[model samples]
Target: MTAAVDTRPDTAPRGIRRKARAYVALTKPRVMELLLVTTAPTMFLAQGGVPNLWLVAATLIGGALSAGSASAFNCYIDRDIDRIMKRTQGRPLVTGEVTDREALIFSYVVGVASIAWLALTVNLLSAALSLGAILFYVVVYTLWLKRRTPQNIVWGGIAGCMPVLIGWAAVTNDLSWAPVILFMVIFLWTPPHYWPLSMKYRDDYAAADVPMLSVVRGRSIVGLQVILYAWATVACSLLLVPVAGMGVVYTVVAAASGLWFIWEAHRLYSRAIQHVAEVRPMRVFHSSITYLTLLFVAVGIDPLLPF
Candidate 1:
């Protein structure tokens, strides 16, 4: 009877749990995971090897929470546009699972907490930078630039590039050429990384009245931009081997991955890129994920290699 009674108490809290889940969904967890991938490697490289476990944990939590805050706010602001896009139509706010007021409160609370956590455990520079990142993502990118121009992701790239710097600053508390290079890698990588996804959802952007490159520039023009950005990414990534003091292992890995990225970009370009097929653009999007993960991991593991 006691054992059975314990399980029955959940009926009262079930609604609360549902609401909690709805709020969590607003953070866009999958995107948070990718963002943290960059953060972890930047810290690892900054330390010239692995960092202290506690510090790494704190930085990751702060970065994730801050990113979540920015993302949640973006969701609320973009709720109208999201409702029109099938991919985001099922989101908590869009589906009425979560109220805008609740989401707004959650976003601000988390946003402030993230900054506080970083300031306490990491450094003021990191805290300031993290705050800047949130503002850039929420205000600069989402509110200001997204609907205004086709160069949305181009300048909006700054928000994503901030984590690498925050991670580096977490360990060293100072910015350096190494992290700057890493930042550039991601900054340049953003256009190609995101443009492919824009292609996948071009029609969605059009319907939602979002000025994504695929909508503004046409598939062929966007494809050309993708190729150009891929080339730029390759150039910047290759330069990191020497600048970051990466060993032969990292050099080989980055070179191979960079070449593959360029090849994919060319394939998209050479094909004329008119039709909205699922395979090609999705492939580019997935490949961009793989490319960044591999390059950052190579950097993280570089110091481990006997040189």
Candidate 2:
């Protein structure tokens, strides 16, 4: 649990800036960016138009806090493994930029603040969903599943899918099939989205003694699973057309981007089966992000279309 200490004076401007950056890194902002991307678009779809700007701002803030809390907790819990895995070696906890106690306290404070902020500004349902997401990511994924099961990310990804439901609940103050379908889309998308990264970092998980599919199963099997989940994600995205009466923009983008995503998955699988040394799994990893962003951008745009 120990990390190297900074001997420099704490009041120095450079030290202050470095400390701020470390705190920010503890939140895993890049991951939060992807979560927030799905959020506002879901709110737009829920409103069937642009939602109130103030409400959008409030929800995004609370969502960021919620995500930050979950990530901080994950950083704390996985600190031991973080020090071992090359991918996580530079995390604040691993680098000793933030202490274990500081991270624990920060996680609790932000989590509680997120619930309170959402409850006051958005609605109770949204706040509750945010709380549920934090708990699921921390308790279910980080503590119970991550080290124990290869299927951890599959079920754990439910937390990442929460923003769509929370955004809908914030706007409508209720649940419906439309958000559920979007939720399923993300749920299925998570495996394909994440497995590629795990494939790229198979040795990291192996070193950490974590049972990621890429660590536990052969590359070919993991590639096949990615293709399966990619197809399912695309199929789930299409459900929005009939369920929500989505228009031209969403339908075309969903179909085109889905085919692109599926193509990437198949390409990865091809490399895996051919026993190519590189396999270059990150290609599909980046492709998944582009696919989701484009699909959700269509989600936001479709509701405002003229015809």
Candidate 3:
């Protein structure tokens, strides 16, 4: 067989600050923060109280590191396509701020180190869950589905949905119904959140041949899907209060938030049907983020708030 070609390119002999920034860019901080937000509530909900201090800390740290590693590997894999997308053109890998060798080594080191910490300090179940998330993200989502199919995000959203499972397992060592419900909430939420961003960058995705919903289906169809997923997410979010044994405080907040989420989706559908710019879809996407964070935070604080 012929030797595999390394698609990785060279980087500059750079200053320390630039090098540091490249390493930081590999982690995709905003995405990691959002992932952690989901993790925190699962911990609290699992116990129906505040989570254990040490275990929560260990799991979050390990989860964040493993997430970063997988994200870095994604950058490595998508470097070429990223260069074609204006939105991702400045990414460290695309810009040659870091080499593929550097990224690969960094990803492997962080992934192994994070899993090792989880196995030793946290429970083995948590470690295995974290590793599974990484593998799903890197191997299934980034490497396989992304380039080949329009359904990539639909299937690959599983990796993003795993943090709640990890958090619950970290505490109870059991895969309870609560975390599974939480997974459903996030899984349904992913499409509406991402498709709008993809709509905003449809030309870039087309250039990269990435087969995003926005690139494959027309805007009308994708917008409808976003609305449908938005409705599903709201329905799933409402289930959290009863399923997780959250209080009336959580139920009230969820009902209110879910209403706003549905409103946003309706607005997006209206705009898309009219062939308006995707600004409304983008707004819905941002509001979806706020809705999830607020719903989960409400869940986390339910024990403190009187019903």
Candidate 4:
């Protein structure tokens, strides 16, 4: 499914200053901010507290560029449907802030630049992993999966999980069970984290004909799935305690915050079960972000503690 080339006049912004903001918006800054939150902490765990500042800086920049590259391509690819969805209606591409050609070119240029930067500044393996993530997001998830099935995000979420691996690999230049477990934690966490947002935006997806889980399934079914995945996410997070040799801080925070996340997930299900007029799934969505932040913060902090 090819997105039609945007022919709208480039009235995105007249000043160079204004145009930079439009390009940044193409990266979906909010999502990138969340993606970045996971990067350094994993590096911390890999290095056991502090890695070289230069290496850390390089990995974060590479990760950001890789992520931004993918998002730009996504903006280009989804330009047509983007206009139909209210949440995405004001996107630069939709508003003619950036032309399709510019978005497409920008995606490739920054994407290639990121790979080169990583390979030179970081390790080849980390760079390769970053490149793979870019390709998977553009080729597999965005192009093929997003519009095809209700299970789109379930598998497509693999791309989002790459930063953990990339961050770890950047430090160690190799793969191990620790990062893999953390990867699985994010993999499981994604569905529950995203489904609530999907639930809130179900109508928008429905109108756009995108088959996100909430659009295809009832709220009760989606809530049940959220609960199931929330449990799986918590289980996966605990594995880090042993696999990564994490200590008391991580163990306690993981266990406690996980229970709270599961409880919130249950609350969403309970509301759905009761056929409430409005099930506020955003509660779970926002909590999921906080849960992840706390879990990873502990991951970063545990290694620095004397205990």
Query: What CA root-mean-square deviation does each model show from the true structure?
Result: 2.8, 5.3, 8.1, 7.4
Instruction: Please give the distance, in angstroms, between residue 30's alpha carbon in candidate 3 and its true position after superposition.
Output: 0.7
| Candidate 1 whole-model C-alpha lDDT, 0 to 1 | 0.90
lDDT of 1 at 250: 85
Error of 1 at 130 (Å): 0.3
TM-score of 3: 0.92
Q: State the lDDT of candidate 3 residue by residue for 1-307, as single tens digits.
A: 9999988654554577789889989999889999999898778878778878888899899989988998998999889898889999889998888999999999999999989998998789988999999999999999899989888898899999989998988888889777888899889988888888888888999998999988989878987898899888888877766776778888888889988987887887788889875455678779889988988888688866656
Best by lDDT: 2
Q: What TM value does model 2 have? A: 0.96
Of the two candidates 2 and 3, the one with more favorable lDDT, higher being better, is 2
Pairs that collide in candidate 1 are none
Better of 1 and 4 by TM-score: 4
TM-score of each: 0.94, 0.96, 0.92, 0.95
* Candidates by lDDT, descending order: 2, 4, 1, 3
List candidate 2 segments past 4 Å from native.
1-11
Error of 3 at 36 (Å): 0.4
Error of 3 at 128 (Å): 0.4
lDDT of 1 at 24: 85
Candidate 2 C-alpha lDDT tens digits along 178-253: 9999999999999999999999999999988999999989999999999999999999999999999999999999
Model 4: weakest 10-residue lDDT segment is: 9-18
Q: List ranges where model 4 is wrong by over 4 Å.
A: 1-14
